[model samples]
Target: MAVVVGFIPTPVGFAALEAAQREAERRGGPLIIVNVVRDGMQGDPRHADQGQLERAQDMVRRASVRIAVRQEHTDDDISDVLLQVVEEEKAELLVLGIRRERDMASHLLGVTVQKLLTSSPSDVLVV
Candidate 1:
């Protein structure tokens, strides 16, 4: 099973990516990075640009495990997209990143994280 990580273009997201890479390496499994772009949110800061994705790919390539980066565009809930990926990939673990803001706990309790926490078949890790 792969290690699946939800990736956004943020510091927290990169941290999650790194952690997921380590987990994948430890498990001798592939790493799948899922970057979901909400419909009409292509310009959103959270959506990663091609350069950023390339950089992320380069970072992951430095490790020994295989890597796949998927940039999915959808109108559905982000959590749904991630859960679908988890099921499709038969992921052993799902990792997410949360911003370190004043209301960090609120971000942790957000709909996407909460949904995955309750609904995902694989283990969930938030970094």
Candidate 2:
């Protein structure tokens, strides 16, 4: 089984990749980097651009783990895409970047995070 990481072009995304690298190393497994966007979506600030994806690939290559990077455009929710990655990749763990929010609405947790925490069979690591 591989280690799966949700990736974007932000610092938090980098942190999640780093953490995933360590986990993959420890497990002696491949790394699956996943970036998902809604079908036909454009210019979403949360998604990574081509250049950023290339940089992320370089980083993964340098990490020396067997790697697969998937930029998937899906109609499904991001959480479902992530969970699908976990199942399809047979991932041992799922890693994601998270930023703390003080807003009361956010205290309930984001929909994606909540769905994964409740539905995922694999362990999750939030970095």
For every model shown, what is its TM-score relative to the native structure?
0.95, 0.90
Report lDDT (CA) for all predictions.
0.91, 0.85
For 24-43, candidate 1 gives per-residue lDDT tens digits of 99988799999999997657
Best by lDDT: 1
Model 2 lDDT per residue over 69-123, tens place: 8998887799898999899988999998876444535733778888987888799
**Model 2 TM:** 0.90
Regions of candidate 1 where Cα sits further than 4 Å from its true position: none
Please report how far candidate 1 places residue 10 from its true position, in Å: 0.9
Report the error of model 1 at residue 57, Å: 0.4
lDDT of 2 at 120: 82
